[model samples]
Target: MLKMAKKHNMCFALIKLSQTHKQQLPAWLHCGALLRTYHKLKDACLKQIHEVKSIKDLLKVSNRPTTVPHHWESHDCICGLCVSDRLAGCKNPHKCISTVAVIINNLTPKFNPFYCPINDGLTLTHCRLEKNTRARTQHRGDIIFDPSVSETLQLAECFRIFAGDTRTAQAPAHRLQRPNQGQGQQEPPIEIYTDSSCINNGKNNAQCGSGIWFGENNPLNKAIRITGKTQSNQAGEVAAILIGL
Candidate 1:
């Protein structure tokens, strides 16, 4: 009836029609413009639905009291704090904390391998880790540290050698030996060290730099300050490795 009134330039408020007028409206009058309006309305309805669902999920996981102090023990009723902080005046304001209040009070604790702070700061900011964005072929295993074991000490020694610890005056006896094959000894493997640095890391204006080091005073050694919007410590590390290769 409203569509008909609007189409005929009739006053919508003045029309006195019952619910039966809904079916009496011509189907042809509801074709083109009505379909477009319905599509727009559908989008708005879906947006509201998604917003409600997101709020529900957020509240479900959050440790917040959503009601007045008296009704907090009840499971069915929501708190007045959802609408406004002072909606329900009560003495115990602590029992009416919102989700945002709970988050702010707790400082957004870390949950590893998912939503966590990029740095060690106790801020409300978080970074999301999507499973699809990670490499499917590679597996990142857990790390175990034990200084008491002899194998751990041996592994540390090997790591020091691979990382080019110049504190050692000479290479170990095992590393100096060459494999003998048919009366000919094979040459030792070439070792290169690559590293990266990022200043103001985890920020939008972060700067990243990479460096590749061969032997002392080697001509192949290079230092590069990376330039681009894609600047992070990980990106710099990958860039240094690629350049070294």
Candidate 2:
């Protein structure tokens, strides 16, 4: 509707201006005179939508060529050249400069990978371990020790030492010293570590074992023989902790 109103006004102004000025204009100037009058009417219509800052801008807007219809094209519209002219000047010079400065400051610096900051000469390049050294040996020959004799000796010593030490039997001190308890008397908290193994995981004889380390020196240590279930050392360790919990 706005475009139609602009065209109608332009046509009316051209007719009126030509009738008034025809006597003073030459015959060859008819087209040029009408075109100038049409542009003046178009400029007046544009003034209602946008601000004109200077005489130069007003004259440029008022002297732009009129668009002629093309029959080969399905629609008639002016190109964007005149519309871009309306927005050409920067209204805020300071804001434009600040925006450009921010853009320049954000760019990342380029560096060679061989001389990159993290890889620049301060890092060690090799391991320090001796390549062919052998570990020390523990015993020259195997002499099997009697497991029951050692156990009996250990148990006898424990009994002798604890016989005079009444603290282990004292319920109040026992409960107070219990690692897990906060107050009063209670059983000590126990932590267990376990492991298991199998000859074959899918369908063969399997074995599992678990060991308990109780108290500071791992005293009262015990291990259980397990079979028929397959698992790794890590899985056994987890199972031990779970059972202890």
Candidate 3:
């Protein structure tokens, strides 16, 4: 009983001191065993933190579908997503809403696109294409992503509901809506075949490169450099296709 009480007090003390100016780290830092435990949980915490961050990244992308006629005139329907329900269900409503707002407002053309498999369609680049064209990249899942304009307002809703801010909270339900085929016409996609290869497999230093093959006699053929940290055969192959795209 005494040992349990001591442990409880130690945790409470750590919490209180963690917020201090940080001239000194919490004493727990000195405990290698404790750090090992923290390392074990690091992946789970990173996963959750990344999911929340993805909501913020969504704001940096454009919501307009470039292929749609008069895309500039069309209002993003994703913006209509209601957050009142999410707020009502949140235990820390104020923090959640505020964090979400910040994340959702970051959409822009300069943003780098990424995928979060755990997130809804509102955050996916595939969903940002013309409604009918979304199918072309549907199977790519979170692997292939690019910044786009389409259903951006919905991103705000997603951020508002998912951001925990400084507190821990469960996010409400959300999902990417199916592309609603609008009357607008779509631009044709350019087609090409991409491939990659690497030499010297698990050796001291390997050479890897990506390549794009357009057609039997097409002149747009070339090899791409993908050498940095990834000297593996698969990384080279994947890099080739991504570069081609």
| Model 3: how far residue 70 lies from native, Å | 45
- For model 3, residues 1-245, the per-residue Cα lDDT tens digits are 43653444322111111111121222112211112323323223222432323322222222323332332322222222213323333223233333433333332211212221244434444445544354465754334353322223322232232223234221222344547646775656888888777789767688888889887777788778785776888988788777777
Per the 3 Å backbone cut-off, how many clashing residue pairs does candidate 3 have?
Answer: 16
> In candidate 1, what are the lDDT values of residues 126-168, reduced to their tens digit?
2222332233334553323212211112212222212322232
Which of candidates 2 and 3 reaches a greater lDDT?
3
CA lDDT, candidate 2, residue 236: 58
Local distance difference test, each candidate: 0.42, 0.33, 0.39
TM-score of each: 0.25, 0.19, 0.25
Best by lDDT: 1
lDDT per residue for candidate 2 within 1-245, as digits (tens), equals: 43653444331111011111322222221222223232343333234433443323333333333332221111122335433333544333222223323322232111011111222222222331121111114433343322121111221222222122222221111111336656587665655554454344444454556666665677565565543355555555566666555
| Model with the higher lDDT, candidate 1 or 2 | 1
At residue 199, what lDDT does model 1 achieve? 93
- After the best TM-score superposition of candidate 1, give how far the Cα of residue 94 lies from its true spot, in angstroms: 99
Query: How does candidate 1 score on lDDT?
Result: 0.42
| Winning candidate number (TM-score) | 3
Q: 224 in model 2: Cα distance from truth in Å?
A: 2.0
